[model samples]
Target: MKVTIDQDKCCAAGTCVLVAPDVFDQRDDDGIVILLNERPPAELHAAVREAADVCPGAAISVSEDA
Candidate 1:
């Protein structure tokens, strides 16, 4: 699974980071969404999906590569 976050769409609410700290974070100054891991381990796929689901701004995207 691959994860991507659109900073332009992010509200900086930190929901994604709160859901999956290993995959998402906030920039220090702007508090924008930051991609901590563009490609996370399979073990973390579920958590990454959860973060994408709960993102209020719809900033997170998850794709599965077969």
Candidate 2:
């Protein structure tokens, strides 16, 4: 899977960080999401998907690799 975050739409809710720290983080200054691993390992896929779905700002985007 591939992941991306739109900082402009981000609300800094930190849900993504909470759900999958390995795949996402927050900016120190503004608390915006900082994507750490654009392509997370298979074991972490569920958590990554959850992070995207539960993001309050809807800034997380997950796309399957074709």
Candidate 3:
């Protein structure tokens, strides 16, 4: 799976980070969503999807690899 985040749309809720710290993170200064892994390993796909689903700001985007 591929992950992407829109900083402009982020509300700094930190849900993504909590759900998938390996795939997402927060900037210490403002707690904005940060994309830690653009293309995470297969083992992390589930968490990445969960993060995208629960993102309050809808800042997380995921694309599955064919």
Candidate 4:
């Protein structure tokens, strides 16, 4: 799985980070979605997808490279 975040579209809602702290994080100052791991383990796929789904700004993208 590949996770990417569009910072410009992100509104700092922190949904991505909230759903998957292991893969996503927020910038301390602006609270933007930061990619902690571009290609996280398969175990984190579900949470990563959930993060993308719940993102208020729709700034998260998840792709399955399997």
lDDT of 2 by residue, 7-48 (tens): 999999999999999999999999999999898899999999
Ranking by lDDT: 2, 4, 3, 1
Candidate 3 overall Cα lDDT vs. reference?
Answer: 0.89
Single out the weakest 10-residue window by summed lDDT for candidate 1: 1-10
| Model 1 C-alpha lDDT versus the unseen true structure | 0.88
Please, what are the lDDT tens digits per residue for candidate 4 over residues 1-66?
888889999999887887899998989999988899999998898999999999999999888876
TM-score of each: 0.92, 0.95, 0.94, 0.94
Residue 44 in model 3: lDDT = 92
Task: List candidate 4 stretches off by more than 4 Å.
Answer: none
Candidate 3 residue lDDT tens string, 8-54: 99999999888899888899999998798898999999999998899
Which has the higher TM-score value, candidate number 2 or candidate number 3?
Answer: 2
Q: Clashes in each model (backbone N, CA, C under 3 Å)?
A: 0, 0, 0, 0
For candidate 4, give the lDDT: 0.90
lDDT of candidate 2 vs native? 0.93
**For candidate 1, lDDT tens digit of each residue in 12-65?**
999888888988889999899999899999888888998998888999988897
